[model samples]
Target: MGDVVEMTSELGFKYSILASGSTGNSFYLETPEKKILVDAGLSGKKITSLLAEIDRDPSDLDAILVTHEHKDHIHGVGVLARKYGMDIYANEKTWQIMDSKNMLGKVDNSQKHIFSRGKLLTFGDIDIESFGVSHDAINPQFYRFMKDGKSFVMLTDTGYVSDRMAGLIENADGYLIESNHDIEILRAGSYPWSTKQRILSDQGHLCNEDGADAMIRTIGNKTKKIYLGHLSKENNIKELAYMTMENQLARADFGVGTDFKIFVTSPDTATPLTDI
Candidate 1:
């Protein structure tokens, strides 16, 4: 009898932050067979140019997934979807909230896919799982994407990381997590008491220490990269966030550039593409 042979191709995934931080948020993800966008917080013009910078065409995107209807996350969605004829996916409540606010202008109902918490959506060669997160939005959710055996998790804009969130992030190959503010600086700064309280609450954004704690708990030997994101313009500095996260991880016996790679994204400008 002749020997039988089976052939399989290795899967590849690549990601880049088109923009990050409170000023705006956008991320680009590409696998061998799909191109996906996480958010469109930047202006349409900027998003288009950023795609060019990364050697990708806006029209080539397979889909645009929205985490919430916050202005910083939906600012450019209308223009980008209209121009590229791309479909958008969000939860039913999120879509309803967006429509009530006229956030994305007039998107076709047929083009909007309503996703619910705990459901998995498939696109091209990737599978995406959306789970609820603590954020001030109509049913806010974070994403976990898996292709072949590699997985990536993106958790941002949450005030605190719950056990459920940590469970989702465990053993991820790549992570884009929030490190929004310094609690002491925010408390002493000029912002109103109400705003500060909101930011520090469970539904608000994560502070540096909180973010670092989450990273230390979730990171594993398979975690290849971590990008600190959504820094506050007033209370947080890039250096402070980076140093805090690095120091905390060191206490846990993980060193940056040795145990894993780390990077920071800016509110403006696209970060270089990273392959996983």
Candidate 2:
């Protein structure tokens, strides 16, 4: 990812990816009032440093929103929330599994927030709408948030996106989506047969081709930015992921920078602040 951020003169919601990929995943979203983190798959120290880069303090966040109980998504959720005494939000099933596994040990009961899948929840001025995603987890969901007349969709970790889910998120101004792997590379790679089979299954992750195809199908007039995340380190590279999607869109008669900006988030570094 680069430092070029799509910015406007007016004050609005700002977003940045702290880290994204198989090792860990986390991102920051801020309105003028609320500071929210999508996931804390990384360590507490790493997340804090990333926040420091953006001149934000860990204590400033209003809430930490978890997508699922996978370690890559919630590894640091406990430590961060405990350190800041912050509110943590997840669906009841996710919370139960995490608690049962002792993944997030001893969180404040009052600070634990829950929401129902396929329902809308409000946090101050932000409206959070979650829909079930076909991931191999205990009722995983993809989040759609609306605030100040603008909307964003966070869709990732799912094996495939259903048409109904596509329609639900088509109107988003910003979409943070997964471009996990390359089909050919994955099939020919050195991983074991069973692991590869599971990955290629519907309950696994999305491949680059499928993700791009879905994006093109669901893209709307309101769409402004497309973030490509959750890349595979061994099976895929950044250039391959970017070009595969870019070329597909180009073939569909959509200019890259002109139609909508595409930001390729890295697994290690934080992208520049982008205002939406």
Best by lDDT: 1
Deviation in angstroms for 228 in model 2? 0.5
Candidate 2 per-residue C-alpha lDDT over 110-223 given as tens digits, one digit per residue, 9 for 90 to 100 = 989997789998777678898998888997987888877788888889899889889888868888888999989999999999988887889899899888988887887778
lDDT of 2 at 104: 91
RMSD of each: 2.1, 5.8
lDDT of 2: 0.87
Poorly placed runs, candidate 2 (over 4 Å)? 1-11
Residue-level lDDT for 129 in candidate 2: 93
- Candidate with best TM-score: 1
Query: How much lDDT does each candidate structure score?
Result: 0.88, 0.87
Candidate 2, run of 10 with poorest lDDT:
6-15
lDDT score of residue 165 within candidate 2: 85
lDDT of 1: 0.88
